[model samples]
Target: MKVVLQRVKSAEVQVDDVSVGQIAQGYLLLVGIQDADTVAEIDYLVRKIVNLRVFEDSSRKMNLNIKDVSGAILSVSQFTLYAQTKKGNRPNFMHAGKPEYAKEMYNLFNDKLREAGLLVECGIFGADMQVNLINDGPVTIIFDTDSNY
Candidate 1:
């Protein structure tokens, strides 16, 4: 499992000229699932995302988690995160999980986040989505379940 987290003043997802999900002030999560990913990985990623201290406190320090700030989450499925571009000019997506598996994990991930008491919004899985966001502080981070970074 992998995620690209961006602290955003606002974010939204549109499909076929229709807005499906949107958030005012929160995080936009671009999520990717691998073949080896399981519920455990999903659990870990959700915990980390919610508890991430990207929001600032009264002292202007990034010490508050999303929950502390009453922020929301916009989750979008992005299999391209697993794209392997080390070979030829074209990138290979062999590492990306199958569509069915990806969908399952994606839904589970969002459900878990909602269960944690955060208002969650999501893009249609497997749909071509256009995401818009005003990145707060331009703060972004890439996180992986398997890697220690």
Candidate 2:
């Protein structure tokens, strides 16, 4: 599992010119799932995401987590994070999980986030969607379950 987490003042996703999900003052998560991803990976990532402190606090330091600031979440399933471009001009997606499995993992990831008492919004699992975001502090964090932050 891999996730690109961007702190944003606002974010939204559109499918077929219609807004499917949107959020204000939160994180925009681009999530990728591999075939090997399991509940352990999900739990690990969720725990870190809700607790990672990157928001600015009264001291003007990055000391506040999303929950502390009452932020929301906009999660978008993105398999392309695993794209391999070493060989040629065309990228290979062999590392991405199969669609059926990937969708299941993606849904589970979102459900877990919600279970953590978060207001989570999400894009369609396998749709051609457009995303818009206003990055807060332009602060971004990436998480890979197989590696340390």
Candidate 3:
């Protein structure tokens, strides 16, 4: 499992010129699932993302978690996070999880976040999506369950 978390003032996702999901003042999560990913990994990431202290506090310090600031989450499925580009000019997606399996994991991830009392929006699993966001502080963080970062 891998995720690119971008703290945003607002974010929205569109599919086929129709708005699908949107959020206000939250984290836009680009999620990727690999073959080895399981519920345990999803559980770990859900906890980390919700409790991540990336939001600013009254003292102008980045010390508040999303819930403390009443923030939401916009989660999107992005298998390209595992694109293998170390070989030839073309990128290989062999590292990404199978579509059906990945979709299941993606849905579970979003459900976990929502169960935690955080409003979670999501893009279609296999649809072509257009995402727009006002990145707050341009704060971005990446996490991968298979590696120590």
Candidate 4:
């Protein structure tokens, strides 16, 4: 499991020129799943994201979590996060999970976020999506189950 979390003022996703999911103020999550991912990895990422203190407090210090700021979530399935480009100009997607398995894990990840009392919106699992967002503070964080960065 891997996620690129961005603090956003607003975010929205569209599929085929139709709006699919949107959020007001929250984290825009680009999620990627690998064959080795499981519910355990999902649980870890969700907890870390929700409780991440990216939002600034009254003192201008980044001390508030998403829940504290009453934020929502816009989750999108993104296999490209695992794109392997070692050999040549062409990118290999062998590190990414198959669609069937990836979709299941993606849904599970969103469900876990919703169950945590966060308003979670999502893009279609296998659809071509267009995402727009105003990155608050331009704060971005990446989490991966396999390596520490």
Which model, 1 or 3, shows the larger lDDT?
Answer: 3
Residue 13 of model 4 has an lDDT of 99
Query: What is the alpha-carbon lDDT of model 3 when measured against the actual structure?
Result: 0.95
Collision pairs in model 1: none
Candidate 2 has a TM-score of 0.98
The ten-residue window of minimal lDDT in model 1 covers: 41-50
lDDT of 4: 0.94
Give lDDT: candidate 1, residue 50: 84
Residues 1-149, model 4: lDDT tens digits = 88999999999999999999999999999999998898888999888988899899999999999999999999999999999998999999999999999999999999999999999999999899999999998899989889876
lDDT of candidates 1 onward, in order: 0.93, 0.95, 0.95, 0.94
lDDT of 3 by residue, 1-149 (tens): 99999999999999998989999999999999997899999999999998999988999999999999999999999999999999898989999999999999999999999999999999999999999999999899999998888
What's the C-alpha lDDT at position 120 in model 1?
A: 96
lDDT of 2 by residue, 56-123 (tens): 99999999999999999999999999999999999999999999999988999999999999999999
Structural RMSD, model 4: 0.7
